[model samples]
Structures are given as C-alpha cells and as structure tokens.
Target: MLEAIRERYIFNKCQVIILDDDGIITLSDDHLFEVPNAQPIENVHPFFETIRHLFDDKNEEHVFHCIHLEIGDVIGNYNVIFNSGNKEQNPFLVLYDFTENCNYIQTIVQRRNESVIALEFEQIQAQRLQAEQVFKNKLIATISHDLRTPLTSIAGFAELLQKQQGTPQGANYVQLISQSATVIKDILDNLLGLAKLEAGVAETQLKKLHLPELTDYLEAIYAPKMQQKGLQFSLKKSAPKNAFIADTTRILQVIINLVDNAVKFTEKGSIQVFLSVLAEAATEPILQITVIDTGIGFPQEATEKIGSFQRFHSTDVEGSGLGLSIVQGVVKHLQGKLDIQSAPDKGTTVWVEIPIQYAAETATAVQTNSDASITLAPLKIIVADDNDVNILLFQQMLAEQENVQVIAVNDGNTVLDELQKQPVDAVFLDVHMDGLDGITTAKLIKSNKLTKHIPLVAFTATNSAEELDMLQKAGMSLTLGKPFTQQQLLQVLQQISATK
Candidate 1:
C-alpha cells in the first residue's frame, strides 16, 4: 500500500522504503535518497516503545512509521510519520525520496533570483544615465544664461557709445566691440539652437520656398559678416539647375549655419557654397548644397557630432554647440541627407541634400510702381503702449523722421482723452493695453464716425500671418511685430500715412 501511494505521489526520480509494526523492514527501494544514511529503523525502534504504550491504553495501537528523505547529490530535507491500523492488516512504514525534485526547485529559485537581479541592474543604469543627461542640460543652460547677459550689456553699451562719440581709438574699439558681439551672438545662438534641436522642435516646420531667392537673401546678410572675419565667400550653381524646393527656412538655416561656422573656424580661408544636382536618370531628383571651407579641418572623432548642440571649438573660438544639431535636424526634416569629410590640417566639406522640385523665374517684376517709399507729412501720431522700452525704441526710431510728432500714453482712457483734445493723423495703438484693451479701444474709436478715417496700426509682437490677417480684417490698417528693424518700422509707418 505504501509503495503504490509513493509511486503515484513521487513523480520525479525517487524511491521509497516500507517497514512493519515491529520495526521490521518490509520493502526497500530508497536508493534515490541522497541524505547521509543513519542507523536505519533500528535506531528509532526504542523511541516507539514509549509512544506505543500510550496508544495501546487508548485502544489504538501504533502500527508503523514512515520517513521521507532528500538525499544523494541533493542536501538534507526529510520528514517521518507513524501510523496505526485499526481493522485492517498490520500497519507499515513508507519512505519517499524527494532529493531530485528538491534539486529542480532550487535550480528554478536560483534562476528566478538571477533574472530579478539583472532586471534591477538594468533599471538602475538607465536611471543613472537619465539623471546625468538632465544635469548636463541644466548645466549648459546656466552657462548660456550667465555668458549672454554680460555680452548683451557690452554690445549695447559699445553700440551706444560708438554712435554718440568719436575718436580713432573709439572707432577701433567700436569695431572690436561689434566683433565681440558677433562672437557672443554666435555662442548664444548655438546654445539655444542646440537646446531647441534637442527638444525636437527644429525639424517640425515643414515650410517650402524657392531656393535661389532664399539663398540670395542669406548670402547678402552674411557676406558682410564673413568679410569682417577675413574670409572670401561665394556661391555657385551646378549644371542642370532647376527650381529648388524643400523645407525652406530650416534648410536655409542649416546652410547658413554651416557657412557661418566655416567663417568663424577658418582664418584666411575661402568658403564656397554650391548647389549640386544629383539626379540619377531613373531616381527622384536630389539637390545637394556643399559647403566647402579651406580652413584648419576637424578631428576625425569630433567631426561626427559637428551639428550637435553645445559643442564648440576646443579653443576660445566661442560657440554654443547648437549649430550642427540644428543642421542635422533640418536635414532630417527635409527627408534628405547630410555627410561630412574632414581631416586635421585639411579643409572640411559638408554636403547636404534634399528631394525637391524647382520653379522657373517669371519675367515680370513686382507691379507696384508707386515708388516703394513715398514721403508724407508726419502727422500727430498717438502711440498707445504698456511697455516704456517699446515706446522709447519707437519714439527714438521716429524722432529724426520728417514732420513727425509722437504722443505716448499708457492707458486706454488716456488714449481717448489725448485723441479728443488733438486732431491726429493716425493712431499707432498697442493691441495689449492695461485698460480699455486694444480691441475695445479700437472698436470705440471705430464706432465714433469722426475718428473712423484715422488709420490704426497695431503694434504687436505676433506677426504670424494668421494674426496679421485677422487684425487687418478687424480694422487694423497695419501690423508691425515687435523688435522690428528701423527700416521695417519706416515702411509700415509710411504705408499708414501714405493715403493721408
């Protein structure tokens, strides 16, 4: 009976032993047991005498005992039990060998523990890396902020001093100061640009534009800056040229950055920018712009992250490390490609390409023959603004203009009072006001039939096409975004007063 039950219960490689009530061995097949062998059932035979007497007094005689052992190669794990038969045949002892089964459980437990440890280790490493990246970013941000503030003050003070004062030394100092400002601007731009590229906002603007016109404008802006740096800059077109199309602004920014970097990094070197037509007879046309510079080239290792953020020259060539990152993003956004070839002491070349279609130039010129600039009697222009700096910048900008006088006010009610007392030619109103907000003031001014003819130019910082269009439909004759150049201000102001 014991053997049948043990055989059914012990599925793994195991054996069992059985014994009769007199401490006699009845069956033996405990070879699978791995524990140290003892004095057999004979050693426990004496202890049974003490408990058997108590069982007999209660009309229940102890018949047999069984011992389970985990032996052999497996370590010590065992159990023992005693049984007494009532109406059945004499009781017997049974032993179950559980060493092999115990071994399997231990193996599984160890493997589970190992897997858990590995997972925990991976999690810890990932967390450490993430923390380090954040710390590095914050550190860079702090460095950028600290560097730009003093630079801004230096640039502004130098500019102001140069415009008002004169001396041979002062003129030299002014040129040096302007050079310093450019360097600072480059650093700030790189830092902020890298930050933006890392933030994943660079390649998102998928705007398209004509390549030739865009290049012409950028070349014009940077050509003077490059000349100041003692570098010759030129642009070229490849054979089979066509109208170029792609992510217009981003691509332009990339090429511009590459050219700027080349100028800043090279001394007495020529920087040539050319568009390459790389269309296979069977594939889509690809446009490649290669920026070639005859400068001290880059190290093999350093060239890989040329367009990455916060990276700059090892020397004091001052850069914020964002130009390359922005370039990379632009290339990615255009669904094009970027490649670099450089070696120490040799010139470097960066090749960028984008898949695009081109448009041919039309022969007709812009038809507004009414001389783009027409002079008008500077009327009494009422200026509404919440910012004192803006008011000052605007007032200073218009101070030297012909026949112009500006009346500045801070509040909406003040605007009305000033307007009612004086006959004004136009209202230069700020859309963001403390009271009688811009829209409300504009609506009130429009409602009064007497003031309806006064053209209102909204001075806002949002020149987004949508915002400008909306404000125009809402009775704003002109929208001039903030931080505009002197020329832009003059143009908008002229347009408003042109009709009057």
Candidate 2:
C-alpha cells in the first residue's frame, strides 16, 4: 500500500525517502543529499539535526512544520511528514515545498515595516517645523528690542541738535547724523518686514494713488542725492494720471528703495526712472517702472543673485544687502514680476511690473506743515523704563515744552510707588521690565479702580503687532513703538489729553 501510494501521489521531483529503523535511507526518489549513493539525512543538511527528533519517536503519524533548506544554489522551504503504520513498514519521509508561500509572507512583513517608518518620519518632520517657527519668533523679538533702543537715542539727539542754532558745519554734521540714523532704521524695517511677510503676518493697506504725483515725489527726493554725487537724475512718466488702487505705503517704499539703489551705485552717468502702463484692462492693468543706472554693474553670472540678501556689486558699496530682497517680497505680495539686466562695467536696469485696479475716487495728496508748532498744557506724567539713555531722551524732548512735569522711574514697582505718591495724567510703561513686566503691572493697576482711569501707554522696542495686541488686551490704553519720533510721542500725549 505504501509503494502504491508513493507511485500514485509523488512526482519525479518529490524528495521521498524510505528509512529503516536505524535511520538509514533504504530507498530514495532523488539524489538531493549529494551522496554518491543513498545516505542518511543527518549527513546532508545542517537543519537535519533540528528535525532529528522526529525520526527518533515516530510511533504514530508524525508531521513537522516547514524548515528552510539550501542545497548548493537551490533554496526552498519544506514540511517533513513521517508515516509509521507498523515496524514492519519502513517509515517513509515526504518533504513538501512551501518556498513561494514563505517569500510572499516576507514581502508583506517588509512593506508593513516600511509604512511604519514613513509615518514616524512624517511626525519628526512636523515637530521640527514647529520648533523652527518658535525659534524664528524669539529671534525677531530679541533683535527688534536690542537694536531699536540705540537708534532711538541717536535720532533723538540729532533732532535736539536741529532745534539748536549751531554753525553751518555743525548743522551739516547733524544732518549726517540724522541721515545715518534713518538709513539704519530703514535697514531694520526692511529686515523686520521680510520676517513678517515670511511668517504670513503682513497685511497691506490699499488706497487710491496717482502715478504722476508719486513720480514727482520720487524726483524731489532723489534729485538732491543725485546732484550731491554729480549725477543727472530724471523722472519720465508715460503712464496716465488715472487713479489706481494700491498699497500707497508699500508702493512708495518700493520706489524709494529702487531709486536709492540707483543713486548709491551711479557715479557720474545719469539715472533715469520711467513709469508707463505696459498692459491695460478694465479690472487688472499692468504698470511698469524702470530704474536705470549707469554704474559698476555686475557680471552675467551674478544675474541670479539679484534677490534676497544678495550683494553682487562691489564690497565698497554700503548697504544691508536686503533692499532687493525686500523689493522682491513686496512685488510678490502685490502679484508682480521683477526683472534685472546688467553687465560688467555697463549700466543696470531693473524693471518691476505690477497689476493694479482702477479706483473711482480721486487720489488725495498728503499734506505736511513743517512750520507748525505744538503746544502742551502743564500736566504730570510718569515714565518707567530700564534704559537710562531713553530716560534722558524723554527729558530732552520735553525740555522745550512748558510746564510738562515728567517723573522718570526705572522699574514697574517704582512706577506704582510714584503713582501712589501722586496721580499722574499718563504713565509710559516699558513692556519688558526687570522686576515686574508691563503687562502684569497694567493688569494690577486696571484691577484697582483708583489707578485704572490713568492712561497706560506701552513703550516697547518690539515691532511685533501680536505683542501690541496682547498689551492692549492686558488693559494698556495705547502703545508706542520704540525709536519713536518726538512728534509721535507728543501726538500720543495730545490724544490722551484730549480724551480727558
């Protein structure tokens, strides 16, 4: 019956062996054992020792799980089944191949592990982005606070110098000082503006603008600078004087930045600015402005370096390398395009095209009265700040005005003590103090009805709008950004007095 069963089921490739009680292969269907003749399984493969127990106690039907086997170059998985109907019947061993099933299972396991690793990598990337954003915010705040304080002092002292009747040379020196401070302030503003735009916090204030008036203003501002450098400056306006809807401040800043670059680089040749409408539609019209300068131009290789903190010009030129970057950002924000054309020793021309909408209302010009004088009533005010220079600046700025009693304190606690001694009309509280922060102090003062009526103005070097909003929510009546002009300071006081 065993021989009949082997003949009926086993094929020519089947590895079947009939073993005797001594575990010797009495007969075999194949020579996979690499034996010169039929031999025992123990001498064939290393995995035989692990399955040797099955041959020892084969009293009844015995079956073993799949085992890996490698014979020379051929690899496979096999299940061993032994049949022992009686001692008289030689126990026959049958090895079944399951290599394909094992390979399929291994592939599934490998794919599953890859999926898990991919998920873990995504989580790590998310965490890294969050950390990066937090670091960026902290860096911006620290830089804004540290840099604005000194700039404020320099500008304040320069303004004080202007108020005095000094010699012509001294007046020139004061003008230089003021101009230097303004340049530094512009650089800082550009850096902060880029940060805000990158963080998606910048918002545009759009208004109706007249192109001819804007070009005229630019000519007025840059002509003097060009004359100082012995360069001819001209503004050509080919665009219509139609009113257009745009961000007045941003557009003006972009123009100023472009003109400033042209004036800075040009030595003797003329700098021409041309404004024209490149394309006109009912809703969206394209406006093009060109700033062409004959100066030490850059090579063709440096053309790609025209954007974002890039200095392709000579190192002798003084700039923060942030002008073009800020310009690019503003153009992108306005849905515009920027192009630069230049060559070595030749001139450079920058073209900016922006899409603008037509506004129905006529654009109004901004009016400024340089000769106007401001008068203030006699009132008591408390100033709390940690910086001594800022305190002195406040005193100097208020010295010209009559009967303005200014009491200066160093910390928030001193501010409270001063308030206790006498009720002041307003309190200038620095947001970041050593002992008590301005927000906590304001909260405490507002909680008490006796001191709540007094206006609390936050004096901070931080340019973050979010920080100002937080201070306002904490009961601060108003906020004064650092490096403030004397006019801005007086304007806040005037508003507070008017409210009273």
Candidate 3:
C-alpha cells in the first residue's frame, strides 16, 4: 500500500516541503530535485524566496494558493499552496507544476488573436477600395459630361454647316471640323473605358439586343467613311435568330473598336463583319462575331499582346492601342473568348465568342432607311437643357419636320410648369439642370396623373452606368447621349411614337 501511494504521488506531480527554524526540515520526496526546471531543495533560493513572506507573521496562520515563480533560470507557471503556523510549529508548501500546459495554451491564444487582426485589416482594405471605386466612377461621369457637351455643339453645328455650304472647299472644311470632333470623342471614350477597366469597375448590364439592328447601326456609322476612303465595307449575319441577351453598350463598344481598327489599317482592301450563332441547341447559344479586313496586317508578335497597350507598327500607325485593350477587357469581363489571326502584309481576322441566351421573343428584321426620307407625325415636344447651344441644336435638328413644335426650357422647374400648362406628346430632359434636377423632375412627372402618360426621354451628356440606372428608376423610358445626329433624334422620336 505504501509503494502504491508513493507511485500515485509522483504521477500526480505533487511535492511537499516542511520548514522549521533552520528551514527545510523534511521533504516528502526527491521530486523537486528530479524536475529539470526546478531548484534543488538544498539551494532553497527561488522557491523559499517565493514563500518566505507567508511565514513572517508567525502568530497568525496564512495560506497562499496558485502562486507562480521563477524556479531556476527559467520562468515557469505553477500552482503552489503554503500554510504557516506559529514560530514553534512547522510551515508547509505544496507545488503542482503546469508550465508546459500553460505555454501551449498561450501559443494558441496568440495565433487566434493574430488571425482576428488580419481579418479586420482585410475588411478595412476592401471597404476603402470600394469607396474609392465609387468616387472614381462618379468623377468619370462628370468629366465625360463636361467634355462632351461642348463637343456636341461643335459637331452639331459642323453638320449643319456641311449641309448649308455649297462650295467643295467650304464642305471640305466642315468635314474636317466634323471629323475632328469625332476623333476627339473616340479618344475620350477610349480613355474613360480604359480607366474603368483598370479600376475593375466596368460593370455589365444585360439586355435584349436586336442583332440585325445592331449590325445595321454599325454599317450606317462606318459605311460612308469607308466609301470616302475608297474601301469596301459590308455587314452580314448568318444567325438562326435575330435577338440575344447581352450588355448592349459593351457589345457595341467591342464591335465599334474592332471595325475602327480595321478601317484605320486597311488602306485599300475590303472590311467585312459577320455575326453568327454557334450552338448545339437553342436554349444555350453562343454568339460569334468576326471582323475580317485586308488591312496592313500586324506581325505575329503583336497578336500575343492583345490585352496590353502595346502599339503595333507604331512607326506608321497612329493610335494609342487602347482600342483593342478595351475590347479584350470587356470580353474577359463577359466571360467570352477573343482570338486574333494576323501576319505581316497579310490581312488580320479577329473573332469573339460570347455565351448568350436568346430573347423570349425574336425581333423581325429592321429595314434600313436614310435620314432624309424619315418623317414624324405632328407632335408638340418640351425640351429642357441648361446649355443654350444644346437647345439651339435640338431646334435646328427638328426644324426639318413639317409640323413638329419644340418648346424649350433652361431648367426642370420650367419643364414642370410647361407640363402643367399644356399637354405634350413627349418630354426631353437633360439630366442635370438648375433649380430642379432632371431625375427629380422625371419622378414628379411620372407620379402625376396629368403628365404621367407622356413619353419621357433623357437626352443628356452623362452616360455612366450608375447615373443611367438612376434615370431609369426615375421613369425615363429612353436615353440618348449628346453629340447625337439628326438620324438618332428621329429614331428616338419614332420609337416614342410607336410606343404611344
């Protein structure tokens, strides 16, 4: 039984020491000497120092529990109990070492604390980046509007001058003015697009697009220019259907940049655009668009740097190379694929494949028409814009219509007052106006029973996605950007008329 008790005592890692007038009168075992980190009883240095105060008051009994001390050179965690009696009686101390266990627990707590700090830091960084992106998007929108407003007046008057001028020299000057405005607009678009993409805020907004109409629009834009350069341009579609769901703006941007590049490089050869559907079933279809041009082709090395802003044949070509870079970024964001095939002196072919869903209702083919041949029904329109030039441009664009009447206002308050005075067929509003903004005016118009039936159009210079969404929510059914031509305005009028 005694041997069993001794074995259990050592296993429990317990030790006891008795102290008298001479100190260390007796020890239960040699466990303290056996412990590697503990001081020998003969030294009585740290251990005795740790409990000496308890015995100072000899007349009163004292007990110390769970006391930790430096045993030798190593600081260790320990639970110690001490009892002191009168001076003539003995004092006893009990020790239970827990240094290893406490160290392991301390390490775990330190790691957990570090992990919490790291997570908090990451959250803060993410929030900061998100805030910065919002500010950047707003700034881009403002800058675009400010720059494009004057450009719109410049281009609009240039078009008017080109029509009024009879001499070939005067027409040539007007054409240069118009072309310069267009080039400036293109540069602005490329810079804004690149900025958005680099900031990772180039969002995708999906909508049903009529493929045939899109192609027709592109042809109308580039055909005349290509003809002036003595180059052939044609757009073809071999799709099973005419409608697909995608980001309409992004799709237009991609195709426009590709065709523009083709037109810029191709000195004499033809530029052809093809749109086709690639799929095994109608439920999940992939739209493939290919742009082939017999242009001054680039080297194979240039093909490898599609997403980068690396200019090709820079010695002869005049471009920042941001066009193709914007195209690549938009394609990637849409989870599509882009391929370029080219060789020196050989024409280049660029193709993009995007997964899409066919619209629920397929649209019929749109018959293309010249702007001069189109006309609108007799209608009274209210136009609101802060800029007098924009208002004047609108009046001139509508002057050709036989019975169309345009009532112009410089602010949204006047627009509202006009609506209150008379019934109009449509309301055209610039998004930013003095006194009352266009968005609030739109909401008021939409909410009122008297004016809610009229078609609302946002003809503004700001075209940011966030602002567009705001305009839509405020009940604008259609949005046309500034620097628009007579044809575009007529198209918007027709659509509004048709909807009504």
Candidate 4:
C-alpha cells in the first residue's frame, strides 16, 4: 500500500543522494540538490560550500524541515532527511517536496479567513453575540499564533542577512525577501486590527503626540515609494502651535492608510497631505488631516459604502479596502468625523477631523555642553522568552549597543535565578511562556526587595485593555507589542535608562 501511494503521489517529486563517511556526495538523483553534469560532483558549486557543513557529523542522522532550495533554474520546497546510521554503511539523503501541500493549505486558510472576516462584519453591524465574539477571539489567537510567530523568524533572519557582506545580487535578493516579509506583516496586522475592532476589544492608548514629528516620519516612509512611481508628493503643515493628546497608534494608522491609499491609486499625478487645526467649530478645536490624490475616483453612489468593507474598481485594484474601514472605525471610536469627495477621472480627497485640546505643558529643550560628553554606565539586561527565535532576534537587535550586555533565558524561573546572582538594568519578559508566566514572574520580582527596583517590561501580542490593565497591575513598567522594530526596542531601553 505504501509503495503504491509513493508511486502515485510522490513519483518525480523526490530526490536522493548517497554520501561517504566524510560527507562527500558520491551519488545524486539531480532533482532538488543537483550534481554537476560534467564534473565528478565532489564540490563544484558554491552552493555546496555552506551545505556541506550539515553532514560534518558522520555518526548521527539529521533532519531539516521546509527548506526552500534553489539551484540554477530549479527551485523546490523540501524536507531533507539524512541517515548516517553506522560507519560501515554509506549515508543516504532524501528530499521530499511539499510545495503543493503548502499551497493547498494556504488556499484553505485564505478561504477561512475571508469567511471569518465577513461574519465579523455582520456581527459588528448587528448585535454581537457572545458565541460569535468568542469565535472571533479564537480566530485572532490562531492568526497571531500560526502566522505572526513564523513571520518573526523570517523577518529576523532577513535582518541578519542584511547585515552580512555579500554580492550585490545576493543583497538585493535579501532586500526583496525583507520587503516581502514586511508586506505580509502589514497584511497580518490589518487583519488582526480589523478583527479586534469588530470584536470591540481594541484598546486606545492616548498620549502626547507631536504633529510635526509624526508628519516627518510618514513622509520619510512614503516619499521613496512616491519617487519610485514618478509621482509628486508634498506634505503641508498649517499652524498648530502645540502638541495634542491622542491615541498615537490609531492616529498613525489613520494617516498611514490614507497616504498609502493615495500613493497606491495615483500613478502620474501628485498626492498632497495637509495637517491643520480648525478652531471655528461649535464645540471645541478640531485637528484636520486632508489627503488629496489625482487618481481614478468613485461614483457618488458608492460614497456611502466606503467604510463598510466596500471596494470600488475591484478588478482594477488589488485591495480589500480594509484600510478605509479601519480608519472609519477608529474615527467613530474617537468621536471624530470623516469626509470624502471624488469624481471619476478627476481626483479624490479624504478629510479626517478629530476633536483635540492643546497640550497643557509644552516640551522644554535641554542644552548640553558639546565638549563635555556624558558617559553611560555599564548595563546588563535579562530577556526571558520561551521562543528561541525571539530571544535571538532580541540579542541581535541589541548587539551593537556599547556598554550593554544581554543574557537570555527561556523561562521565568530562570530569570529569577539569574537576577539572584547578578544585578541587571532591566528585565524583558514575554507574557506567555512554558511555565511561570510573565505576570506571575513580574509580581514576584516586584514584591522582592532586592529585585523590586529593577524595571520589568512586558512583551505581549495581546492589545486588549484587560491585558494592559493586568500587566500594569502586575507591576510591569511598560509593555511593547509583538512585531516591534529595533528602533522601538532601543527607544524603550533609552526610556528605561533615563528613568533609572
């Protein structure tokens, strides 16, 4: 039965190789890892240089899972298994292709994700039943677990590759891979954000926001894309003398989505973003963000359906229109207003207005003597994460900083033991772990006299208000969400150092 299945399903999708005790490939089937045609296959290709290290141990069998191998024009996703049982027997390597299986699984997941999103939209429009809410929560959890974790590994490796010295073509390939991973990460974030919004579990974190700095950051991000497309992009700021208190993350999302939409649709013309404060309103001052784009516009009839998971020109555009929906949701939650105007072949203009109050206290500048430089004290940080990939990513991100050392531990208990031995500046704990979860560990650390002074930062993917409250109550000084960038980590560290 097994033989029949193999012949039917895996006929030409398998590759084989036989190696001597010294890990030299003597025989090859020329499917996945191909042997040279004219050469004796001893070590002809540069690709084999790194791969030969896998067989250095001639006594033990090795298994590598889901390796995407490219040789010449042939590319295959394979699971490689090497058997080097006894010294007397030659080692055999088997490569099994699983590309079709992966595609099938991806198709199924895509269909399921679409269905769940549709159901979530319906729930948001109607009364949100408890069962449906629970189902949505489970979907969110599954997405975070199944997608974001693996994406982190991919992104981490891509970042590492970017730091390595390689040929121009190799560097370009790594850059492309990094960009693709970022796009995937953005899609996942949007899906997760939409799900959380529909479930009414999204948390709003309001803080002081510097408008000028925000616009500068957004322009830096989209300017290159605009240049690449041969489109003119300009950012205009009106007189807003003071910073305002707002949900920084949501506001960033709103503007980014609007600008991203403008960039995506406009091909030959210009896109402009304006930030100004309108004080003539009846109630209070309002912050207005307007985006103007010269692109294909929609009909007046479709204006009302813009925020209901609606898409215009579905065939011409590749988008789910979730960005606009997210923007609308955030505005409504903030008790703000959204206005959109467009005409076919003319242009599109979107205005987002949110009520605001100028900050009570303005930031004061500090002057330091340039000739007398300040020196930072030596610091040690303990990072506790159950996932090895996360720990490695953290270490790599912090590796270049001077006067700082990072010690990695897999669990909370190990963290406590490490703290007992040496003093550290800060401890970053992953909220979920195999044993002694972050909250409990944090409480224990805070309650102890010796370690209570050390700052404890929580790294979590859960953005619910309840989770944030729990972390705060458990004595967490701060919480950073998952899929965070190196700059964010550095900023957190800087803040901790300043506080200390």
Please list the C-alpha lDDT of all candidates, in the order they appear. 0.65, 0.74, 0.75, 0.75
Q: What overall lDDT, based on C-alpha atoms, would model 3 receive against the true structure?
A: 0.75
lDDT of 4 at 125: 67
Clashes of each: 12, 0, 0, 0
> Which portions of model 2 show Cα errors greater than 4 Å?
1-165, 277-281, 305-320, 360-372
lDDT of 1 at 457: 83
Which residue pairs collide in model 2, if any? none
Best model number under lDDT: 4
Report lDDT (Cα) of residue 310, candidate 1: 29
Considering summed lDDT, which 10 consecutive residues are worst modelled in model 3?
A: 311-320
- Ranking of all predicted structures according to TM-score, beginning with the best and ending with the worst: 2, 4, 1, 3
Candidate achieving higher lDDT, 1 or 3? 3
Instruction: Give the per-residue Cα lDDT of candidate 3 at 41.
Output: 42
Best candidate, TM-score? 2
Superior candidate under TM-score, 2 versus 3: 2
TM-score of each: 0.55, 0.67, 0.53, 0.56
User: lDDT tens digits, residues 26-141, model 3?
Assistant: 54553543332233343654656655656666655444444455645545566666667565667666677676777897899899999999999999999989876764665556
Per-residue lDDT tens digits for candidate 2, residues 1-500, read 98777666655335777776665677776633333235676666766555566656657666766678887676777776777535668777787766777789879989999999999999999988877676456545545654676677677767667766577756775776776677677767877887776776888876766677788788777878888889988898776656677787787777787887777667779899888765455457777889999987766655666543242322222342455656777887887888888776787898888887676554434444354566666678999988899999988988887768999999988888888899898889899888998889898888888999889999987767788789988889798888888987887877777776
327: Cα error in model 2, Å: 1.2
Please list the residue runs of candidate 3 whose C-alpha ends up more than 4 Å from where it truly belongs after superposition. Answer: 1-166, 185-319, 339-374, 419-423, 446-454, 461-469, 494-500
Pitting candidate 1 against candidate 2, the one with the higher lDDT is 2
